[model samples]
Target: MTVIENIVGRVTVLRGGRYSVEVDVITSSGFGRFAAPVDENPDLYIAEAHRAVSEVDEIIGPELIGFDATEQELIDSYLWEIDGTEDFSHIGANTALAVSVATAKAAASEKNLPLYTYLGGTFTTELPVPILEFASDSEFDYYVMVRDLMEITDVVDAVNGVLSNLKEATVEGYSEATEKASSELGLDVALGLAQKAPMDMEKLLTLVEDNNVAYLKPMGDEELFLELIAGTHGVFIDGEYLFRQKDILDRRYYNALSIKPINLGTLTDLYNLINDAKSERIVPILAEARFESSDEALAHMAVGFRCPAVVLRKDSIAKLNELIRIAEDLGERGRVITFEG
Candidate 1:
């Protein structure tokens, strides 16, 4: 048995000088580390990171000392019980997730198994398709949905060509630009939008219709959410607004949902949500928080969960590079997932 010996947390400074908590879980036979980045205001991120580390060293670490690292469900339950909060507001969700994931990694190390193999079993080989978001020099953002990354010899060059066309095209001409780039680069590309604020429904619908946007992350009231689903034709509506609302799946409000580990609080919770989404025939896309660490555990989780797609930004190269390595490791068994949405 791999018994938990100690848990240590340190403040880690990420790119752009952002702060995150790096957790080290030490067990009787192995060790694991994970960095938890919180989605907080830039001004308060440093303080939040420090507080999480302090909570781990003084509170969570001491309580979990004698627990078995392999008993993931029990450890996650204890995390909720100790926090005594419905939303993990007391201890913070990022802290709980860090501890939960690190425990899994520790147990995997004890057995000399890869993290994905430990969590997903021996036959998990399919890699999720990368949903790469590129922002042009003109500040226009679009997504390149690669059908098969292994097929592309130079992904950077292909994406550069896509961005160049996007820079010259107007918002109304985005669909044409994407289509042109797709034909020239021989890649399946699509337009994507993330709603940061409320917009007129007519305007939103017009943009979606005109640009042929295939992916949307909308944030608004239930009416707006339902309207987007109803108005668009074959658009992949990501359920960012519907996080933790599994009941909404029954209504089929969104075809896909973004799974962020920090929002779920623990690995058990994240796993349950992914299973719930799949059981409902909804696609689960592993997504990072607005702010993130360089940790590549998320890439492993995407493969482990068998998620079809991963929504990642340009700066998330660490996760992308990790996916490439996982693909190479899987060899002939590795294939990009077909995006259903």
Candidate 2:
């Protein structure tokens, strides 16, 4: 009978020094690696990491060591049971997600096939358009290295560049720092905003209109979140930033759903959210589901959902390469994506 041979957990820092929980699972046939998301607050994240590490070593490791790894339903049910809380506060959502994903990865690794294939990936040639981000000429130039950039504005000549529009591009102090970088390059690229600060509708709408912001990732109350940016270019619901599930009950309010698997607390919840969004014609974004390692990447990718886009951070080749590899494995060579820092 296939069983978990051993489990190991470690706390590591992700890009920008965010703490994360990394987990590894080994079975007779293969191995798996996964990690939990981190918090920006160092102290809070470190505490969560320590808790996860302790749980794995003292409690979780013993309970599931002899359990069959292939039996996903059984394992996940156990995960739900252990957590008790709907949001997985007890067992730590990050730990639970890491384990669930690692188990799936181990099973796939044993087969020696792509994780997407193992998780029912359909072979298709259709490619999703990728949205590339630009900060400077150097950043823009590097977009081609990624192999699937749609909005790479690396071809800016000095004359046609921002010189003529220098006054417009080089504003005194742009509220949106992201826009400042790309806008300075004078590329015909659209800008997006994450309104972390609260604002009235008039002010928010005017900001969107004046800046010609292409999308809004609002962070605040449900009513205000929707009010500030809905029906604009596109409204993407970022639970990490926005933090309300009930806010998305209405289908017409927003057209895109973005999430991290860790934030959802379980694979089941993540899939349910994706399916619901798809049914309602809302774009399902596997965006910001930051799987730091290859195993986490495959486990999440193998769910067999061809998303509208998956956001990739522009920090490391490892991250970008992993994303590209997942897309290729799923026969989705060009998954729609927007670059973020």
Candidate 3:
């Protein structure tokens, strides 16, 4: 048996070409803290589990042995089959969660950041504590995890379920399927924004009354505000409001603001417009840029570069940083600096 199993704790290869993996602490101290029964021979249990998995592997591994592990859905099919077998739900769930988490960790490692950083939010502080609520599930394409606390009771289970479901959904183009479910359930869904700085709990509740807002974001400082706007997609700026658009929003790409100067499109006019927007604390998202010496001209061109002139509400620093990051990432030729109050 040319077993190529690597050591990552419970990752193991047993005879009959079976593989079993577990993500659990095998230490006595961990068992002591739990009220559950502790196995004196955890190794033996692990071994038996692997043997069982190997037997099942003989039946399924051939179909998948040389397949991609990074393609989790493909890997999950066999696991799902194992789950359907007699007395395998707990093991299957545990195995799947561990494997899924490992895959996520690996991806994050490739990006050289923590998993939450990969999700969003800067690694400037500790991870925000997520709020947990236990209600009958409804139809929201996305659920925003709110609160700044490290942990809240009651929500742990739901969060895991949502995360797991989200991963699977992402792998499968879950939007189409969810849309079908929403139609069948007759759920009236809408998308909107929530202001959540210093945790605006009441405002969030109020915004949700309409249920039209899909994304509720806290308006941070200048930098953060800009970042948030950069993050939003599918809505283009129209005058002062974000008008809905049919195109999918790409969080990665930059959108430009359009400038109008009495039908004269000159470099001087462009610079002035871009500068004016910046002077007013509006970080203009520019498209179609070329090098220009004057900061004034560069700034003006930035403003009138695109639709709706998406600007952050002043004093949102985190948002300002985010916006600056977006511009910088898109190779805008200006260095971001804070204005003194």
Candidate 2 least-lDDT 10 residues: 138-147
* TM-score attained by model 3: 0.24
| Model 2 bad stretches (over 4 Å) | 45-48, 124-188, 220-247, 289-303, 327-341
lDDT of 2 by residue, 1-341 (tens): 35898888888666555666777878998887777664323444577678888887777777788878778767777888877777677887778877877777787787675555555554532233333322333111111112224422232221123233344332112223333434565443344444545567776666666763544655556666566545354434334344353545444455555555666665666767777777976666564433343233622352355555554444434544555555555452434344321
Residue 125 of model 2 has an lDDT of 24
Inter-residue clash pairs, candidate 2: none
Better of 1 and 3 by lDDT: 1
Residue-level lDDT tens digits of model 1 in 18-132: 8878889999888999988666545547777899899999999999999999999999999999999998989988889899999999999999987888889899988887776
| Residue 175 Cα positional deviation in candidate 3, in Å, after optimal superposition | 43
Quote the positional error of residue 173 for candidate 2 in Å: 8.6
Poorly placed runs, candidate 1 (over 4 Å): 136-141, 147-158, 244-247
For all candidates in order, the CA lDDT equals 0.79, 0.55, 0.31
Candidate 2 has what TM-score? 0.73
RMSD of 3: 22.5
Q: What would the TM-scores of all predictions be?
A: 0.91, 0.73, 0.24
